[model samples]
Target: MVKDREQNSNKEKKLLVSLIWNFSTELKLILMALLVIFTLATLLPFIPSSFSLSASDFRFCISRLSSVNTTTTTPTKLSPENNTTTELVLDRVLDNGVIKRTFTGYGSAAYNFVSMSAYRGGVNTFAVIGLSSKPLHVYSHPSYRCEWVPLDPTHDPVSTTGSKILTDWGYGRIYTTVVVNCTFPSTTTPVGGNLILHATTGDPSLNLTDSIPVLTEPPNSVDLTLYTSSTKKKQYDYLYCGSSLYGNLSPQRVREWIAYHARFFGERSHFVLHDAGGIHGDVFEVLRPWIELGRVTVHDIRGQERFDGYYHNQFMVVNDCLHRYRFAAKWMFFFDVDEFMYVPEKETISSVMESLEEYSQFTIEQMPMSSKICYSGDGPARTYRNWGFEKMAYRDVKKVPRRDRKYAVQPSNVFATGVHMSQNLQGKTYHKAEGKIRYFHYHGSISQRREPCRHLFNDSRVVFENNPYVLDTTIRDVGLAVKTFEMRTIGNRLLRTRQ
Candidate 1:
């Protein structure tokens, strides 16, 4: 009986050992499987699903994972429908020289600032133009002296060509310069006023008006006597031409350009030059005789920083000339130094004006001359004789071929001017002199050449044997004199430098 019990106990111990060993093996297998699953979950995001996965996409996915936390315990406030709510916040307002306004219900909207200026004639009249979110009815009221004056119904608001609504909210946002003529308390005294612009969105009751300040004097008013060289004090007859010159130009070239105009226009024409920057001292020396003779005047524009770019400053310079010579000059031609006004039918500009006397009967004050562009050719001579007429004698030259249009104008009829066009305050008409006159634009050859040569016209496809005008011998003579003067000046400068 004792032997039987011992064997039974040994059998039970072997069975228990086999069961424990099997359980341990199964646990190890399960733990290994779980470890594999965990590893795969961690590395699944690292391995791209497609071979075509881009670097940007991978970076975006990494950024998103880093921004989110799956183990967060804090509960988020969820909407009733479990949807996310977004709120738009208004940050800050910026006025980068443009008019901007933000409305409560209509979101934020911006428009160009309303500008108001009194007419040069007197304080009784002023003009305003700007962009508006709604169709605005502009009205004027004097601040320190007079009461609210309604805009003249006869002078209604007009849409300008380049004006447009910047925002997507409304239509007809462009408001042109509407002249508001009001009876002032005193015309001589400079008065400050405010313009009230009423905005309407179809409904008359919902109209809103905003006040804009108006000064009797313009903020950018240039001195009237700034750049005049005439000593006689006589009115400039018919045409007074001027140009804004930038960059270092040869003295001989400068004299040739000035002399060409002087020869063609005669004593009736006077030129004002605004030397913006980079004008060599030699240019001034070459022009000293003309400067003393009151034919050419040069003003240093290095100090003026009113405008941003070179072109804008040029426009301002031209406008200043207009205001300065308004009473002194009958007509003003704002052109570049390389450009020359040519009237094939007449010898002088005064004669051209006399020919257009019939057109002036209809109150046509300004004339628009088209430009004929001339290209350069390989040549030895830098200066082209007779204003490059022989070299550029082709009929297919680029020209402004339109009637009742002109780039030149009567100064008294113009309020302001741009680079090429004038804004007339007197509501004058433009007569285009397409066939009768042409602006010789010698930009290509004038800046490149140093001597007069016939080889410059070799590349011209077409050539004409007939001469356009009687060859002005005075131009050639003046050119020679200028060349001689430039040479002497240069030699003297070199000698002084050596000493």
Candidate 2:
């Protein structure tokens, strides 16, 4: 009876195996599909109805459940902040002990906070803020007293009193910005910098502490509270404030740009590179040398992308850079990495600027160089051997009408700065910069990583548009000089190129 039962079980097992084999992969696939569908069905109900899922996101989920899928996805509207309400993005402590906080505040009033910085300027202590918001109630807290007191509350902030929007220029920004200034009582000392917030006047929300500079007269009375300025020795003569650099940028181009600028500007020059997304992959390696030399400082501002502000929060970037280094540099140049600031031959940039010390701000004229057009020696094959400028020798000589301009400024005189020029300040702007200063713009070339030279021109008959391409080998020669300088200074071992 036991043997008979065993035979019957073996026969049944064989029959099942035969059925599966005859159906080919159909049976197996159907079972797997059903399993995946069931699993996704279980998870689908748990996910929130309002959760946003892009096409790519759905593709990712499908890949995870590759055998089959059943999850029903519903898209939701997301603000610049990843979260719905009141998300704090950046809370960085500045080098001078002032704390800079950036938040995605809760509102639909179109009013938003960018940043507020408080520092002692000469005899008075003042706060300079860049934002588009309600009249902020300013508060100052002395370390000794350990209390927050209103500086300018119920005051006529509506009227102009050392307060103005740096510039009312933005590319369809959700929150429009203006400059709001309030002075702290000179008698009181701060633990950190002064606290300025947007709330009902005199009603403080959150309290935080920081350290600032102390006074020698009242040593014991005023402790180290709001120290926002560096000593004279730590200051720089020249500072470069870059815009929000984003997208796929050429690593080698970035390398050449930094090396060339550093070489051109000499030592005493510092570059503030705000990386929105561009500084990735080998780009970091390219900048690592300058960063080590203290010539370059890269800000990882990728978080600002979520905010639907004017071109990756460009205004805020310039303002932050200006305020952060307001006391640091004697002269600051606000421009782009793609735009190379150039002075005429035999004239040092310092000397060129020294001549125009009377002016508070000076704009640099743009030399729009063609990316496709190049001046080649012997019709060389397309190769990444030479730098972009070294190969790209043609610049359009035709004068085009420009609405915007890049500028250099004395940040101390600048209350707030915009993308093009700093207007809300103390002195005259020098618009007549003809032979002294200008920038070489390899238009849309920074975005090109590999091949810079699209076409080589041996003749002057090349006409892409009405703009005439001339054999301006000025910057090209400079590129060669930059290469030589790099080899001499950086050496062969520390440097590496991708051919």
- 305-386: candidate 1 lDDT, tens digit per residue: 3323334245445555665566576566666665555665435566776666443211221232111322344243443333
Candidate 2 runs further than 4 Å off = 1-123, 128-130, 133-172, 185-194, 199-234, 381-384, 493-495
Name the TM-score of candidate 2. 0.65
Q: Which tens-of-lDDT digit does each residue in 393-497 have in candidate 2?
A: 777777656635799998778777888887778989999896898888888888986677767777654566666777777787676688888778666633565
What is the alpha-carbon RMSD of candidate 1 to the true structure?
Answer: 15.5
Angstrom error of the Cα, residue 30, model 2: value is: 39
Can you tell me which runs of candidate 1 are displaced by over 4 Å? 1-65, 68-234, 239-243, 304-306, 310-312, 345-347, 357-406, 449-499
lDDT of each model, Cα atoms only? 0.46, 0.67
- Per-candidate Cα RMSD to the true structure, in Å, reads 15.5, 15.4
What does the lDDT come to for candidate 1? 0.46
